[model samples]
Target: MRHLKYFCILFVITIVFISGCGNSAKTSKQHEGKIQITTTIGMIKDIVNEVGGEHVAVVGLMKSGVDPHLYKASQGDIQKLEKANIIFYNGLHLEGKMIDIFKKMAKKKTTIAVSKDISEDQLRGWDDGTEGHDPHIWFNVKHWITATKTVRDELIKYDPDHKEDYQTNADAYIKKLEELDQYAEDKIASIPEQTRVLVTAHDAFGYFGDRYGIEVMGLQGISTASEYGSKDVSELRDFLVANKIKAVFMESSVPKKAINAVVEGAKKKGHNVKIGGELFSDAMGEEGTPEGTYIGMVRHNVDTIVDALK
Candidate 1:
């Protein structure tokens, strides 16, 4: 169904491009006054908005609670991508299903993976794909600052007229991220060392855990596509029970069935566990809320975890 959806959308986009209805060059030329950017996820979009300010108009292809791992582009989304001046995405197969489309776009436009600038040593080990770095680089504020700098550079190249604006915005955003990084460190530090474990629906927070000094376990693997079988649930249940873990989290973009199953399995073993509040894993919150933004989302997750465990 996912493949079929994207295939149909691509076919429609191909017709639009052939018809010159939404040709990238023509649209870009028309919008020369403002750089039109298209991004895959909300986090990338938020960074673009901060850096680009009034100079760029960013259209995010993915919305709140949408799982990039399983997202398929729609006909409208393809049209938006077709008309974009530059496209930014969280590569490293984070958008696992959109690799071919991104490759196709790179031939004609400034299609970029913002996370590409970070060194491999800074990234956690990822077993899937040819790229070994974990794609959740945004979870680490420092890595995210590197990606934001890349975004600023791309914007400057495309629209040098607003170079100062982009630079100022990037610098300010990075400053805030630095503060956020420290806040996470201090908050996680305040939690008792034995209780600083985070168990979630998936391994999306490996980078988060590594950066903030928390131990993380996911019932599912790095990719949501990975299997979560009886053994996996049983082992996590045993670990949680033996250690008396206070909370297990569910991700906004992922179903809660697996986490619930873990809870059930723990119950069968005579231990009661409660669901920690939903964390914004693969996506942010809704558009209007504080949690919708990058900093707010991180703070919300950290506060929730700290309060629950402490």
Candidate 2:
């Protein structure tokens, strides 16, 4: 009886080992033709799509209108992350909740923070009574140009077989970004300086404000995780009234309640402030739509701001 039990135990161990090796081989084969990449947000996914082109298969965890700051991973998301050959995120606590998971996965896979390439001095602080640098660096086209290079370098490092393709894609994208930068500058400059204030739900546009010389104000702080109190709304209403600003914008990912409060407050003071439009703040627009794309999203925001403020 003892001999039989030992034999069975050994057989089970052998079977388990063989199964593991088979799964490993199968995974390698599945990812042989193209790399499997997972990114935290649509912007990173879009960048990878532009740079990786046909050489990579990418998955984005956050969808349109999903706030990354408070997003927690589901079991399905974890599975995708585990299966990914590489993971990219706009770090600096942008995806504040997913940082731990990324750190844990870093031990086993290639995980990169794309925004880390930008220098600290170039980053702005969260004025909402929080510490650390703001993670919305993509708001500035110039900053995004640098971010594109980071993605390109990572793609080359892992998939040197597609070096030329990645480089070409990056160069093309950078040129488009340059054009976009010039366009934003011209449109924003056209808006009279007195009406250049950009007020939104949260302080997610520091880079945008700094880049284009708009005075940005948010009822809430940098992270949507923090609640915007009544006082914050009151203060923003006062700011809008004092500056004679015509509109306050809504973000796709953030709720419009805070902004509504500002509107109501301003209304009581006889200042009419309309919702400029829904701007793609933390997340992009729907997939397969122009607003769904990074460049399209930025253009949409710029156009909306210019139209409302002009």
Candidate 3:
């Protein structure tokens, strides 16, 4: 009876050990099959999802309307970076202070700088003579379409088994972008030539204005950390009064104080200029909205500019 009792105890222990081993194996397999990806901005996350479809799990580091230039990755973000199989960033110092961290990750992970693929000639520099390329390529639907293709190609290189699906999805998204580009052209054309001047708090709109032929002016330089001096406000007020500019624009990521300064300055000079509308400058709209996606964001920007300027 004692021997039989001892045998039963060993059998139960063996079963428990085997069960635990099985569960661990299952968890390991799940982790191995899962592909983790991180993108610098919400717009890039949208593009990656469009190409990756159901194959990838993506995380966007920057919140909507958060200035990428001033963004600092938290401890959670660092963990995400360590686990990510692939990473994507806008590059061109868009993530201003975060550039060094991204460069370090590029050495270890499959990091892709989406905007780096754009030609240098197409890029515009910040007003301070800093040649750091403008990182807002999504403003131009054609340029975004090209960047999406580059993203698709990079994703496929990492996950070749889903190449066909990625290519198909990217092609469809590109067609949608082309349609968006046409719509932008039509909408922007409705605005009178003189009203096409876009003045904002910072120099973020150079790419958009250059793409659509609107003249862009900003009270501050590209970096939001830079202070807007009285001279900057005075000069802008002069330009507004001289050109009879009807509207000045504010950015979602920037404080309204700078824009208010422009308005007050213009008012002091006897110019009646209205604040055009809130433009999605450095970042996009809230998640789950139409402006959340890259195409939707640009379309909203075009509509906002036309509605105000026209």
List the candidates' TM-scores in order: 0.88, 0.89, 0.88
lDDT of each: 0.90, 0.93, 0.85
Regions of candidate 1 where Cα sits further than 4 Å from its true position? 1-32, 128-131
Writing each residue's lDDT as its tens digit, candidate 3 over 1-310 gives 9999999999999999999999999866655665788998888899999988878878888888798878888999988888899999888788888777888998998988888678888777655676566677777777788789889999889988889999999999988888888898788888999788989999887777777788888888877877889888888889999999999888889989978988988898898999888888778889999888787788888888898899
Give the residue spans of candidate 3 off by over 4 A.
Answer: 1-32
Clashing pairs in 1: none
lDDT of 3: 0.85
Ranked by lDDT, the better of candidates 1 and 3 is: 1
Off by over 4 Å in 2: 1-32, 128-131
Better of 1 and 2 by lDDT: 2
Residue 147, candidate 3: Cα error in Å is 1.2
1-310, model 1: which lDDT tens digit per residue? 9999999999998998787855777866756778889999999999999999978888999899999989888889889899999999999888988899999999999999998889877878785555566778888888989999999999999888889999999999999999999999999999999999999999999988988999999988888988889999889999999999988998999998999999998889888888878899999999989999999999999998888888
Residues 203-290, candidate 2, lDDT per residue (tens digit)?
Answer: 8998999899899988888999988787888888899899889998999999887898899999999999898988999999999999
List of clashing residue pairs for candidate 2: none
- Per-candidate clashes come to 0, 0, 0
Error of 3 at 213 (Å): 1.4
